[model samples]
Target: MKKIIFIICPFIGLYWLMSSCEDFLEVEAPNHIITSEVVFNNDETAIGALNGIYNQLYTSAFSSGWQDSVTALAGLSSDILEVIRSTNITLKEYDQNEINPNNTRNFNIWSSGYNIIYMTNSLLEGLANSNNVTDETRNRLEGEAKFIRAFTYFNLVNLYDDIPLLTSKDYRSNALAARNSSEEVYELIIRDLENSINLLGESYLDGERTRINNYTSMALLARVYLYRENWGYAESLSEKVIAQSGIYELLENLDEVFLANSKEAIWQISPAGRGTITSHTNEGSIFIINPIFASLSHFKLSTGFVNSFQEEDKRFQDWIRFHSGLSVYYPYKYKIRNSTESITEYSMVLRLAEQYLIRAEARVMQDNLIGAIDDIDKIRSRAGLELLAETNPGISKEALRETIMEERKRELFTEWGHRWMDLKRTGRAAELLGANNSLWQDTDILYPIPEEERMKNPNLTQNAGY
Candidate 1:
């Protein structure tokens, strides 16, 4: 029960990336001094090691990096955010949907993702050898590490389709790792999430929602199942989370949903750097362009997305803000424009509203039209709109599925790459993006593997039409 002292050893992190294959996943060598005995002998050091992983998550190198993180790449690659036509080729590539194999943004995302996975493996390896930490502490730490590894891989596989699946800290295996099919990667993701659910406790490790708990694992697994079209599992998991009424509830006020302590948030990330409510590192600050700082914003909400929301929709009215005398509208969900006295909001990763949407989609596929409509209405009711039946009665199965997609667009826009990934998974990316984006093609759904990676690893094959 020693007081956890956070430690940073840069060389240990560097060791994981130093492989002869030049493959970003390579992490075969380490020159650091701390051994398993010192690093994981007690709960404090073990948890501190895990906190280091979360620190990596906060830094610009990972979640906060505008060029590489999903907050930007996924936003631009999809239709939600329109990038300013500027000289930044990386941003332009995603905006134009004409990315090349060598696009640095692709490289950044690939490398950063594996760096996190490698760190998680390191944590798992240390935890396995620890005898000083109590059994309860060990189980929780293992669960959190597994959850993080699974979440990182989920993002990688969704974007790259076929990717190297690395679970151990062995650099040789990592260097020689070949791309696994999407199916294989998904199986690993499911297995890890299931393991985490069994090991993690129901309560949050801390009062803040930044830490992953059993519900967080369940929420993510439900999303993975929905993506895989495992309707029964997805529906049941979504229902389990939804039943936690004492712990979670939909916010009546639209503006309150993104607050740091919002009842809606299942898991959130504390802002990096300045460590204030309005830290520039917060994704909210990046999305909200303050006039005092810049004359031109990085990006703005698309006209189509803006117009898609009904005039009466509460989200459109409250969550989106229009610049004076300009047609451009930016996401106003994260209200603090700059660093403030206290932190007011955390970057939201998973929430209760999405669970409702997940259940709705699962119900649609099972031909439970009434049940599906019921779930959709829960979201609509909170949005200050009438129920689905009141507006569009007796909707057919095909039409109801489409309705759920539209609901997702209005509810989840600009949050993550939800819109972009939604389109790809539903077989609608080509049809929807082709008509709107001149550069979009049917094959543009999967980004090409970084060219440098292919050159170093002869075993790695480039994605089609790179």
Candidate 2:
């Protein structure tokens, strides 16, 4: 796979606006201000800049084309079923025992994730030394930069355990840098986000929720902490975002959340103007079943994942749809594919519903039983179902944990690469995936650093068990 090139812009100079009094005539707007504060400053510039950030993630080499590859990865990890299960997919599966670091699946994710890291670092440096920038405005942008930086690092550390800790804009092979362990990489991710929470703003979709803000940072922090086993902080951060929520909410009609008309999103790449509508559909709908990948005809839900959902739950109504034979039991989360010209279609990244799940899981780990159940009830309540009553009083803590995991699966199916990651973290890879994969053991939790990177830089090395 070809490396996905990312355009990184650096901050140049400071823009100083001269001001006066009386008639307000002596003040002149420096052209530099336009570059820094006008085009790159203000709320709208932040939105446009973040738009580019979202575009980077949506690329096929990045997220869109990644679904199939993750299916393959999950096959290795045991999260998905082979679209063709007849002859014996389990017999010829490509587990890490047969993995080539140069394969399209591993390499594309590496390239795409690094590009995101590059863009985040560039933005952070620019914001730090920025001039003529209002403290309030600068704080918000810095908070945003920190959030993106943390997100990139979190994904990097999650997927690849040992990676070059490039906190600055260093791209040269000869540059002095060494691969950082997964624990260390996670530390940097945590520090950047902890600082961002105090600086970001609370944006609404009706307002400017498209850009990364305080709530978005908090959301990422919640997920990151959950990954790192810092349940206390994860629960705290997610609760803060959820409790302070105003515009963000769970769509009463679960189906609308993934549609263009979604009102529950806290952050989304608001689709506007026009862009390519793939055979997978476009506009606001995400097509899970299509003719392009006709092997999808035999798509089946994981029995565990299917049984996790409650009967009459609205999430099933919105996400799970079945028409007829051939291709049925299809996920209709993104059903807004349009012909002619694609107009507005929002790509959901962060939504309030997710915060509730995060809060629930983190609270469960924190041993806040009532709190965890409350959070879960919030999600269930939004689905038009009653809360966990006194008679049932919710499930056991361990059962609740599993239930939350399933709810997250049901809620976040086919969005970002959550399904695959969850399977690995939950230790279900070997069970659901069948046999043949020896690397799904404790050490094979993360992807090895690509051989191309190792060959290019002596400082970089592969992860353990590679």
Winning candidate number (TM-score): 1
- Give model 1's TM-score versus the native structure: 0.92
- lDDT scores for all predictions? 0.80, 0.59
lDDT digits (tens) for residues 1-466 of candidate 2: 2222223233322211111011011222222323333445544454455556555555524343233334334433334332334443431233333455665556655655665665566556656655645677667667776777777667666667667677765444313357777778888888888788788656643465556667777888888877767888888888787776455667676656755535577666544312354422331232355446545443444445556677878777777665444434555666654444543346666778888888888888877878888888887777767677453475789988877886777777655557667766666655644354444455555666667655555666667667
Candidate 1 per-residue C-alpha lDDT over 341-394 given as tens digits, one digit per residue, 9 for 90 to 100: 567787788999999999999999999999999999999999988898788779
Q: lDDT of candidate 1 vs native?
A: 0.80
lDDT of 2: 0.59
Q: Which structure among the candidates has the greatest lDDT?
A: 1
Error of 2 at 283 (Å): 11
How many clashes in candidate 1? 3
Deviation in Å, model 1, residue 56 alpha carbon: 1.3
